[model samples]
Target: MKNILIFGAGSIGNHMTYASIKLGHKVYITDKNFAALERMKKKIYPKRYGKWNKNINQISNSNLNKLNIFFDLIIIGTPPKTHIELLNKCKKMFKYDKILIEKPLCSYLENYNKLENEKNLFCGYNHSVSQSFQKFLYLIEKEKKQKKIFISIKWQESFKGILGAHFWLKDEYDTYLGDISKGGGAIHEHSHGLHLAIYILKKLKIKNFDFNSNIFFKDMENKPTYDVASVLRFSNSKINLVLETDLLEDNPQKKIIFFNSKTKIIWHNSFTKNLDCIDYQNKKFKKKYNFKKNRSSEFEKEIYHILNIKNQNQYNNSPLNIKYSIEVMKKISRTLKNAKHF
Candidate 1:
């Protein structure tokens, strides 16, 4: 079993810790503040996963040096802004086989440069690596051979859902979720839409394409100061994409659809709490593909995938590879800069 060190005890950190332990690995979770660690043990973790394992270690950042133990894998599950900072911190002190940074990798362009082509690094764009997505991709490959495709990715969901998940947050301002500059906004927060689009292009080996983007900003006395919605489009001859992510929808719509002259194909996440679905439609027939899995299963599969990585070739194929997420970051940079205010 691997020894995993997770930095940050927030929602994502708790998910990672639960994943690690469920996979029969030893886990150590730390945060900059002790209260965050306490929250994880006392409330966040036990509440989410039913019960916390006492074996999982909790170490504050100030006390991290006391660990002195080398880990097999390190996962940085902190906020988007602190990802790179904590990554650099981990490298200085820990000996590890791999490091996985949570999605949106970091907030700015400069944060990405330090990680360019880093062989041992990965990100947490977990959806693309999901079994449901794998099945969707397989169907896509078969369908694409017969016709060119058009893609639409929608990750529009209510901001209330995000806040509710954290439960402890008074509002978006309570965390980084309120500010775009800190990497919390419609585009960055819902970047799974962005990454899946990029992943499809990469998998199809699309080299060059034109991209245009527009974002709608939230108006709340200019307090939160972030984009509330985004629409991004990209295309070449064989394929086209229209992607949208927003925080304004009470009726959440999370799906990626690939369509052509005859067929309308879709992949849906959390269509219900425990199911992922794919739909296929044409003039004569319609079909549904369903996967039943718990919320933590994807995160667990992600850690399992990482632990089993034995070489560069396999790692490069990972959906969580930093390279794939780098493409996501570039797209996000362009999307946010092309913003419009409501």
Candidate 2:
């Protein structure tokens, strides 16, 4: 089993710990907050966490304690602001090869370039590793006739659902999810859609593009920015992409649509899971891909693939590495700067 060290006890960190343990990895989780760590330990110790209970350890933060242990893989799952600092700390203690950072790599686009330790660092864009998205890529790569492609993603959910479920710290509310300057809100928070589009464009080797974006906010108290509707547009000779992310829609829809003159492909769930695919051509074709365990399995496969990489050097140059994530963040910064506000 690979030695995996995780440095946060938040929602994403907990999820990563669970996924790593399920894959039979020796996971060492550390958090500055003892309460959060205790909660996670209690939550994962039952039959639900499986036989790997002996393999997981929670390290408490102390003045004299230091993480001087070597790990096969290290995950920087902390907040955006704390990433660089943590990376520097990890660098001093470990000679690790593979490191994975949680999404929105850092708080600002400018901070991303300051990351000196990019050796085998990978960003967490788990959607790209998804089986359903892989199938979508298969079909997309095979097509030769489509001259123009259009991609549009609509991601919507309530404030409580996002804040409470993802960003609510144990006793506090509105940690980062409510802060736009801290890389929160619709534009950066729901940026998986933008990254996914960039991933597709880069994979297809279509480079030239025109882009535009808009940010919006409505009826928010103590928040300096809008959370209503944020729009993104990227177009080229081969593809025209339009993505929308917001926190206002009641039904919560996350879907992507690709269109040309005669063909249209629809993939539902741009964030959670890809469950539906509707292909419309001469006739309408429909296919549904189901995952028994859904999101967990996606994370499992992604973590497993990262674990099995034989050459860390070669793997660092992968498409899903931090380089692409930086590109995505750069575009996002530019988009917000040029966006139209309503």
Candidate 3:
């Protein structure tokens, strides 16, 4: 079994852990706070995965607890503010085959590029590598001959779901998510919508564009100030886009659409907790595709996508490639700078 090391013991950390073990890796997970690791064993993990996994090793992260094992993979599943710091520490630890940093690599985009050229590095925008999106890509290639006029994406969810899963957090203010400068804001947290929209744009060969946003901020005095809602408008010679992300919606909505007056295509998430759907429509008829599985399976598919990398060229070209991630971050950074706030 290949050795896998994961940082952090929070919600994403727990998901990655379950996925790695299911894939039969020798998984070792760590957190800076020992209590967090304790919760993973006693509270967080079993509550989600049904039982504590005996095969998984839980360790406390510290200079005194240095790991001597060489890992095949390392995942930085910590907050955006700590990704760069933890990544550097991973480099100094026993050697690893590759490293995957979770989404929004870091806030303010500071030093975001320092390791972008690292050939073995990747960013986890898991949706980018999903089966539903792959099917969409295939259908899109078949759709190239059709005139494309408009496309829009939405990823709106109440942070209650986040706090509910990670019940330890009292509220948004409990984590970096409440602070825009630290990268937990709506646009950054929900950028999967942005990433997918842009990924399809590249597939369509749209290079030049116009972009702007209407951002709404939560500015409680002495509390973390963040963008709670955002609506982005982008256009090019071939397509126009209206992408929305927000933390205020009671009904969680996540979907992407591509359309002309006569035809439309949509990819929707969470139609049910275990299902993702895609719809294709024309004047004549409509077609639907559904992919259903437990939440753990999403990360399992993502892990397989990472393990299947055959070479450097493949790594660089993979949907998880850092270049594409940085491009998305740049757009987010730009939108935050230019957006008019409410």
lDDT of each: 0.85, 0.69, 0.83
lDDT of 3 by residue, 1-342 (tens): 888889989999999999999998989988889999999999999999899999998876664246788788899999898888888877776688888999887886567756667777888889888788888777766666666578778899989776788798888988988888788889888888888777787787777888877888888988979888888887866678899899988789988887877778888887788888899998999999998867888898888888879798888678888878787877877787786321
Question: Where is model 3 more than 4 Å wrong at Cα?
Answer: 63-65, 340-342
Residue-pair clashes per candidate, as listed? 0, 2, 0
Q: For candidate 2, what is the lDDT?
A: 0.69
lDDT of 3 at 142: 66
**Per-residue C-alpha lDDT of model 2 across residues 65-110, encoded as one tens digit per residue:** 4666668888988877677788778777776768888787776534
Itemize residue pairs with steric clashes in candidate 3: none
TM-score of each: 0.95, 0.86, 0.95
Residues forming the 10-long window of minimal summed lDDT in candidate 3: 333-342
Cα error, candidate 1, residue 259 (Å) = 0.7
Worst 10 residues of 1 by lDDT: 333-342
> Mind sharing the TM-score for model 2?
0.86
The pairs that clash in candidate 1 are none
RMSD of 1: 1.9
